[model samples]
Target: MTINHRAEAERHLSKASFMTGDGPNATPVNPAAADHYLRMAQVHATLATGQALVADASAYRAALASWRDIVAHFVAWGLSFAENDDEHGTYLRLAQRLDEAGLNIDNDIDKITPEFGKDPRGMWKPPTVRRAEWAAECAATNPPF
Candidate 1:
């Protein structure tokens, strides 16, 4: 996984872990923890897939370092997110890291769909798979490592 993505996941996981522990209100907190674990798993899975697609060691290392920084921020925040809506914050931070690293997330439907123009509807099918495929395609082109 890219470092920034991992960091974001780690941050969420840490907060979730704390919510499962002594976090405020304690009930909804567990639900959030569940969400956190699921999201963490998703991030890890995406990273693994990206790693398999990339062959550049240096790029991979840099991505890993970025994720560590994100996780560190989360560790520093502890249970403070318990009262705030921080879900989108992680995505924003991750985007920032990718931007700083000159990495582009494959969310450009226009770019990805145009290539599939021959297909029915002239667009990619199933938004989730489309996103994943676009990301993998982008990774293949740039090779993050």
Candidate 2:
């Protein structure tokens, strides 16, 4: 969760706790108001969770782009990575996870290849798993041909 959102959630939760006289030093509030505060706290907590998800998604996108660029740079520099190498394995695993998560849409080579000042280039992962996942999803959704 982002700090502000988390703080907001905690603050609302604390207010609800105080209203309910959960703290020994706290005075009690009307039961209905306490319920309202509790609900508000839940809302804030949900917002915090949502913020965390958004942050994670943003980080993933940036990381994906960065990793793509790194791989491209290494290949251009003539850095040969065997299939059993850790670097290659890490990227392959990430590609597989992205495929499973339905985020394998950026597998197109031309779309990802860097143009100097452009975006990243695709890694050398075999897109078979990603392709199969996409195919299964498309079939499951029953999209019009």
Candidate 3:
């Protein structure tokens, strides 16, 4: 990734970090997991932006893979911090962005959750569930969009 692209990704990830860690309505949950996932997302975003700037197909694929990993991390964190609606929705949007970018690791909307669904109230679950499901899906699927 170019320096500028990386910097841009850093900025976005920083935004995600703030959203995950500290907010007026932020959930008082696992700060460690929240920081981890948010930082992962930032890495993915940086990879994606860098690849886009260079127009490299291999880098693009790598970036997509990174995004998938970030989604998995988000799900795991969500489960551990079940009451953090802000973080839940934040990761949901990140997953959606990955999908829109055509990563399509596993097009399971359930994995993404109701932040984009019809539910007004957000929900949370255990990290293990999302971690196991993501591992199995990545192992079995061929990037199902």
Q: Which candidate wins on lDDT?
A: 2
Instruction: Please give, for residues 20-65, the per-residue lDDT of candidate 1 as tens digits.
Output: 5455665445675667687876787578657656757767899977
Which 10-residue window in model 1 sums to the lowest lDDT?
Answer: 75-84
Ranking by TM-score: 2, 3, 1
Query: Which is superior by TM-score, 2 or 3?
Result: 2
Residue pairs that clash (backbone atoms under 3 angstroms), model 3: 79-125, 79-126, 79-127
Q: State the local distance difference test value for candidate 1.
A: 0.52
Q: Per-residue lDDT of 1-145 in model 2, one digit per residue for the tens?
A: 3367677777876776666454565566657776887787788788888888998999999999787666545442221232344655565565556569775534443344453333334244434433566689989899777
**All candidates: CA RMSD in angstroms?**
26.9, 15.8, 26.9
TM-score of each: 0.25, 0.46, 0.27
Candidate 1 to native Cα RMSD, angstroms: 26.9
Each prediction's Cα lDDT score? 0.52, 0.59, 0.57
Off by over 4 Å in 2: 1-3, 20-29, 79-145
